[model samples]
Target chain A: MMKGNTRGTEAADGKGSGPGRFLIRARADTNIQLGIICILIIILMTALQPRMFLSSYNFESMAFFMPELVLLSIAMMIAMLTGGIDLSIVGVANLAGIAAGTLFGFLAGEAGVGGLGTGAVILGVGVGLIVGVLAGLVNGLLISGLKITPILATLGTGQVFIGLCVVLTGGPAIVGFPSGWTWIGNGKIASIPVPFLLFVVLCVALALLLERTSFGLRLKLIGTNPKAAVFAGIRKGRMILWSYMLTGALAAMAGILLSARVNAAKSDYGSSYLLQAVLIAVLAGTNPAGGRGNVLGVALAVAALTLLATGLQMMRVSNHLIDFVWGAFLIAVIALNSLSARKGL
Target chain B: MRVLRNSNVVIALILVAAMVVIGLINPAFWQLSNIFSLLKANVVIGLMALGVLLIMISGGIDVSFTAFAIAAMYLVVRTMVAIDYDGVILPFIFATAIGGLLGLMNAGIIHKFHMIPLIVTLGTASLVRGLVLGGVGTSNVNIDEMPPSLIELGRANIVTLERANGTTFGLTAMILVYAALAILIHLVLTRTMIGRSVYAYGADPEAARRVGFKTGRTMIFVYCTAGALAGFAGLLHSSMSWLANPRGFVGLELDVIAAVVLGGCSIFGGRGSVIGTVLGVFILVMIQNSLILMGIDMTWQRVVVGGVLISAVAITALRDRRSPA
Candidate 1:
């Protein structure tokens, strides 16, 4: 079965080897579709609320809010690339945030925002990164070593992580971080939001990692056909482990930004983001079966979804209605993708 | 000898060990009243687990059942309240029908699109939840507005025992209903042609198709059955709690799935039994009850449940590895 898929991908890849190669690659069609959808969304929003939709304030708010979604979608894309998923991203993000928040509280003392200093910020951020990566490593080991299915393994770990967070914070939000910590979340550099900039930098880095590196090639090959990958002498288990760990670290980074933006860390913060992240990754054209995804596609999807959400809010739509739209959109996209594939598109 | 080799036997042994340990820690755990209470509290989960078991056996999964249940039950209760109706049977019938229709929708989409069941169900889960939460407008429906007959049914107890202390325990009608459903499901799965088709499909879809089994119809039957059961569980849940809250069953899918998996129902599909699911439900409820009795923090319950699920999966995988194909 896997050998059949290898031949199919190879044949498809060969067909695209021509003069317009750079512009007409295998995924370019989906990228163009996404671009058109994004533009249509912008036009629709502008038509509905001409002033606010096109305003600088709205853009700034989107920039501020979109970083978390972008980072998470990227993390999700990496996992999906391995023909697996990391459902524990939300839990890991919140756990990492809570861990850093606790460290911040201890180092900065209970003197509120006044006692926070540079040392506290550095230490807290460092702790968050380590904890996040370690959590991902555990998920990797479960999937790769124990041979557990990715979905169930991460589902269990997600609950465990959230439970630990709840125990640590006793089911309340941890607040009162030093003012300096907000720099990562809310700060601006040359009028570009720091979080947004961080998102862009990560996107570029990941795009490089996924497209230009040998590791990236091997990861995609494994996803395309695990049996063929094994025959080619690739360490499938090790690749899966690293993929999950990378996702974990990225989730933690998003957590730090989230905590900084909200100025609090809670076990339940961003509980809704779990489903939304999956939606974005899928909408970005990351095949849930794995082996085909691009960072640029995910970034565009984030922008499109953020616009839709912001536009709906502006139109006085209830949050529940927005959720309904997202769910509908996901179904429509998947159905359309399947239909198009049947047409040999 | 063959029974001894079954994974369900190992699970049954584990359940016995857990019960013995809990009983040793607190003698009250062995009391008739406490056992009844445990069964009563877990009746809803057991019913849902049975439904999940069927779908899993057929190489499909429906995480959206909880959402379907909540929506069906809420709509039924609200309609009844609006019309000032006071019957017990009609509301249950309506809810179950609604649940089955929702399940049919899922089956239709999955069959038509040939999409992955897990992803499709995940999307539908969110879609259903969103529709209920948005369309219902009301967050909760009070029990006082429900039919007096249903409320009475909820309060009816068959065997009440008052302890020496200021506590009482009793068996409820809900437990009886759960037992009946479990037996019915067991019979259907083991003794019916449709059940055999479901198993064949799960074990190997291509082979089942080649054998001329109507895969689409089987999927529809399996999912609709699961949905109808979920609706029944929803009614039981609201009856017990005396309220119908749309958000009440939001995250309970994890528990249902966990229980089914723990019962030796392979997530890979085509390998499970109804009796095993019952044992899984009992073991989980017992663990939760034992933890409460030991005065442990409730937050730790999630950790323990999650840890047990992973460990169980690992052990099963290891056993499969050691056994020759």
Candidate 2:
């Protein structure tokens, strides 16, 4: 890993006469642009609803919604970095939630109130994580071992996961978790939401993983140019598999949190989040074609979009129109980015 | 010998095997009436599959067709109801033209930006669906006001079979329409100059461009044609089901794409056929129908379809690896 870092810095310095200068400058530009977008959204939203938008209650609610979007966006960013996509993230999340919810139901029974125990929560969460990992493993095997295109492979597997969820619950929401389970989703630590704290911890961990580890560097190399990475003696398939697995695990964590927050699990829960996750990742400057990403950009993008959504809801805009705005926003952002890239900006 | 290695041949074999297995499980599946009804039920999907095949062959994809279809169909239906118009041709024209216009929107953006078709279409799909849902509101246009001609055309049968138990089965005008469209598309894809260019471009866009192929125009043509077909499918669906709900055809892209891919169309583009898509549609519809006949739960249908998609691609990939194409 140290050798890899030196090699990267040498290439940067050889061309630009400084170690990390060009890369850091480019990243700083992206961060600055994203920061501006965030501040602009805040100002615009606050202007629209001077009192409600800036209220502490609004912030708390936004905090509640931000974790799942943040986690899903991060998962999507990782997959995009590998020049692949996991369309199955939503499916994986729902499946993991359902698995955990079912475990809760089994331990607590239909009433789900008196049997609340800490052990049951731990067991349910464990089951959810394992299911998520297994789902990821299947996706990894299909993409790496069978040589399937990531998009189509995940699309198919996503359907299968959703189908499994539907079959398990018979097309109805599963509600019956012990009250203790809510702590992960709804409880607070030091006046901050637990889910938000978890989001921060995971984001920091992911940043460290991507920046400080050999695996992350290799994954990026593979994404940038597979042939070049292969020439450099990296095992491309293994890295791709690991990247997808990591995404699947993250998706499961989001799912578990969602189930805990809502106190119910269903196949269709967070179906809308699928496209939103992609939207957030792309907006955060995760190149859809792969090879470039930043955690800070993703975090800021999530904040901006969440603010936009919450503001629209407060203004009484229909949910469907909000979806339209998201779609239009994605296209506009991508077009602008492409135009700038073409101009070599 | 060459036919044995053909991907179409492989798909045909799979379809035949599936049919045989289903037939063995429930011999009623072999009934001509059941088959015709099945074909009729899947005609909308079949038509959409043709458009998808064209896009795939031309090196792009449009998952937004379902949204376009529903939007066009709803517009036509709502207009007809508001004016109390009964003409069939006008509705069909309105639907197809609206669909084509939407496709043109997609083509314009994709061409200008040179974006990935999948992501572009994904965004457009959301935009289109959102516009319809938000603008039109979530309400079903009831069939009480449907034109007599449309309903009659929907029910018009080419042939009928009388059974011992008073049950009857036959092919509808819609099925014939589907067959005609399939044949027409097949001919156009195989015989026309534009079709050849589409194939050439799909095989290698840069090389085709260097050779002076009008890649942009061909892309527009492909997407517009797809949108028109989807519009037609949407109208057919409403005519058959007797309502045009804003939510109609939501998530139907998955079925259409799965069918086209199962028909041996390469997702990477430049490889597929109209006949292969027809066979693929049959295989999917058959699985669905057979599952119902066997009293299997409806949820399992998705699992089966998803499984088929994965296995088909996996098998093709394995074969490609062995041959090193």
Q: How much of the real interface does each model capture, measured as fnat?
A: 0.48, 0.51
Per-prediction interface RMSD? 4.1, 6.6
Give per-residue CA lDDT, model 2, range A261-345, as digits (tens). Answer: 9988999999889888888887887766566677888899899898889989999999999988988887897688667765763
lDDT (Cα, tens digit) per residue for candidate 1, span A215-246: 99888778766877899999999999999999
Reference A-B contact fraction recovered by candidate 1 = 0.48
> How far off is residue B87 in model 2, in Å?
1.0
lDDT minimum window of 10 residues, candidate 2 chain A: A1-10
Model 2 residue B320 distance off true place after TM-score fit, in angstroms:
3.8
Candidate 2 vs. truth: CA RMSD?
4.2
Judge candidate 2 at residue B79 and give its lDDT.
84
- Deviation from native of the Cα of residue B217 in model 2, angstroms: 1.5
